[model samples]
Target: MAFVGMDPERIRKVAEQLRQSSHQLTMVNETVQRLINQATQAWEGQDTLDFSDAWTGQHKLTLQQCSEQLEQMSTDAIEQIAQQEKTSGITPGGPGSALKPGDVIPGTTIPMDGLTPDKLNAMSPEDREKTLEAMTPAQRAAYLASLTPEQAAGLLNGMSPEQSAGVLAMMTPAARVAALSAMPTEDRRKALEEMPEAMRDEVYGAMDREVLAQTIGHDVTLAKTESTLSVEAEAVGFKIEAMGQGEMVVNADGSSTVKLHGEFGGGRTFGSDEKGASVTAGLEAEREYQFASPEDAEKFIADLKHAATSVSIDNPNPIDDVWKVLDSGHHVDRFGGYLQAEGHAELGEFGEIAGGGRIDVLATPSEDKLEASLKLHYDASANAGDFAKFSSGGEVEVKGELEHGQLSKIELKASTNGAFGAELEGKSSSGALLTTTHEVVQGSNIGQGGEVKMTLSADNPGFSQVKEALQNGDVGKATELAYKYSDVSYRQTVNTVLADDEHSVKLGAFGVDVAKAGYHFESKAEVSTLIMEKPAGSTHYYDISGGSR
Candidate 1:
């Protein structure tokens, strides 16, 4: 029984050792299987094998044991396989190891020794250009000689004209001519022309002038054709006027001699001593004059007028007695009755005329009187529509008070507005008859009388239109209409309208039949205010009657 029990214990211990050994074998198998699986996956491009796994004790064996086993496997199995593959006559270092016929080795610099044609042919265009650029003249010449004629020509064509010419000039004459002859005609001519002038002259001298002319003609034709391809350019047009006072003379040397006599509006006038002083190469065309002030200009004009008058009076034979009267100041009263006419005032110096008061007539005599009368009418018709027409005929006596030597309390009466067909008659302060026709239209008769009187305020529309037109853009139209409707009170109303649109308008007054002809008045005004607004956008209305009577 003891022996039996001992045998059972031995069997149990053996069983336990077998179990422990089996457990260790199972762990090793599991690890090996995982490593094999990972390696297989990596070989198939699916998963990576973790070499760190063996060193980190993730496997059954210790790190030292795993490393020793791996090293042994590499030395035995891997090396044996590699040797077997090599022994089969495979090339050393694997595919792409040996250099091909045209392959360049990495990091290899080109040789700078004697450049052979074969070596140059192997270089890239850029490399060749760089090499050529770096070469000395003698070296470049030697290299160029080695190239084929076609290759040399191509290279020369690529070079700048000046550089190519320099290189060509160094060549023998025969060689240069032969090379040029091989090029296109245009290219040949360009190369020949780029040569030194003496060389070019020698070459051209060999050719006939007719041939040279033909070549030039061809070039000219080509230039014209190319020029035609360009678009037409725009031209600017301007009007120029000669504004200086002087005589212009043309000189022999295609220059101009401007002999300035006196300073005119634009340029300095040559003095009397400079009569023969000719200005060679004077201002190109017109001379411009500059005036320091309006007063200076006026004085110049006055001097000119006095000079002209003096010359006329000093003539050996005078034309009329008027000149004689003007020459002698006191003779003026003999031509007309007392110069102190009620409605008339002598302008400037009237001492020459007997019984006359000197009053500077800055304003037009006819216009001033007409405007004054019209203002009275416009004031009386303040309630009328925008469009109203007034006419008058027959004799009308004007009665007015003179305040500060100006007309006031003016009165007018006559058949007007197409009602009475008769000539309009008015009396001057001297009781002279001044006649005007009356034209009638549809409108309320605002007033009619031989002696109408009223006080006119400065705020009145009659004054406002004139003032506004003068101060604004309708200046021109205002001036024109003011003269036209010299007798109308709101004559400058058109100017007011014009001033709103056009900025510049010049005003000028013209005398009518009621006063002496050729009388003029002027003022600065804006163009906009001078236009009148009708039912349409706007219209220019001008009174035909001179703003006189």
Candidate 2:
């Protein structure tokens, strides 16, 4: 009898295959049981006892359970075929009629032939499992192919641990990766939890490298730094504070990224201690290392672990390459490879001084050297306060070269023109108030002779010594050598346009101060320093040796 909306012949074939599989499983289980029983008679130690327990507790049990389920499934499939044949002889639309196109099975909305993945997915877990169990392999594959990756993951989540393992085992590598990658981390963890150790190991080993990294997630906050700059002079004061927060994350493909966010704000006050006018400005910047290579990731993780450990005097292990991980590479991505920064200053009676700058960096490797270029542009202005008022704009270009993964040379060119000024107030020896102000009016040019350039070649004698010390984990020796032959210099010429007895006093400073005075004040300085420390509790001394001009 011909069946409607059904393939009775295919169903019979699949049932026969399942019956054969069940029989094969039964034979394998019997053989394993017999071999284990025979082995136990001759061996009677802990090792043999462990082997016996494993076979009986997990392997044998799993085999028996699977055999029973397959046998039951084959019987059900055969009965369905028989019922279809019996109903085929009845009249169409009668109680005993075969299921027609679009007709659902009793107590379910699942159609016999036109079943969609959406309908299958909508069924309860038990119903879905039963329906899939009854389908031929070709029918099952067709439906599975139509499911989205997330839907496939959902099916895995709904299955028991053994069933989930079986499903994953049956999928191709690509499909398996997609399904597991789509699953939530916790859900995937749960799926791996209840499986036997061997099966769990197989599942883990089969995962793609990138997928495994994502499944075992790692995001760590590496460091945080804050700084405050405070300048105090008679009748004038200002304070600037900055904080930077950074995080490092290992990417799926073994790359690493360090994200940084920094914020700064400050205010300047002038006049008497009780009453004064104030101007304030705030700014924020963001930076990222888009793709530091895998080696750098390992280096950072190693250094972090080293820093957190305590060492004994007799077994000291110093960390090398502490601040040198991501410096040598072309690490920035194309789209967002620029530093983004912006800020505004509120000038008391005047309007506001507002502007920002963008800095773009590009690096490329050629032969044995890596070269990097940087471009910067900034503009800020206000039509008021002498200290705040300004109409200024400028651009800077810098290039650096590295040899053997170490910095060897640098060059800079900058052009700037604008009206900018500064104000200074003080008290005279006889208690007289004194004031000095310098301003470059609109259209005037600064940084016109302000080009400052520096270079350090690997030919320097101390360079190799420093490298060797670091490689040997002698951080103290490395620091000493780095500073001994360091090529650093500074030059300053401050010609007071209008100086008096009161303004002659020094400007107590925090950072280095360089002055070249004229209509415009130009400052140029290049500096590098390294400090070494002795063992703890012993007298600490700095082995500093460098010349400055």
Pick the lDDT winner.
2
The worst-scoring run of ten residues by lDDT in candidate 1 lies at 221-230
CA lDDT of 175 in candidate 2?
Answer: 49
Off by over 4 Å in 2: 1-109, 124-151, 154-178, 182-190, 217-247, 251-549
Tens-place lDDT per residue, model 1, 205-248, is 33333333222222111000000011111112111112223322
Q: What is the lDDT of candidate 1?
A: 0.32
TM-scores for every predicted model: 0.18, 0.24
TM-score of 2: 0.24
* Tens digits of per-residue lDDT for model 2, 325-372: 434334432211344344555565554444445444433333365555
Error of 2 at 103 (Å): 11
Local distance difference test, candidate 2? 0.48
- Measured by TM-score, the strongest candidate is 2
lDDT score for residue 518 of model 2: 19
Cα RMSD (angstroms) for every candidate in the order listed: 43.3, 27.9
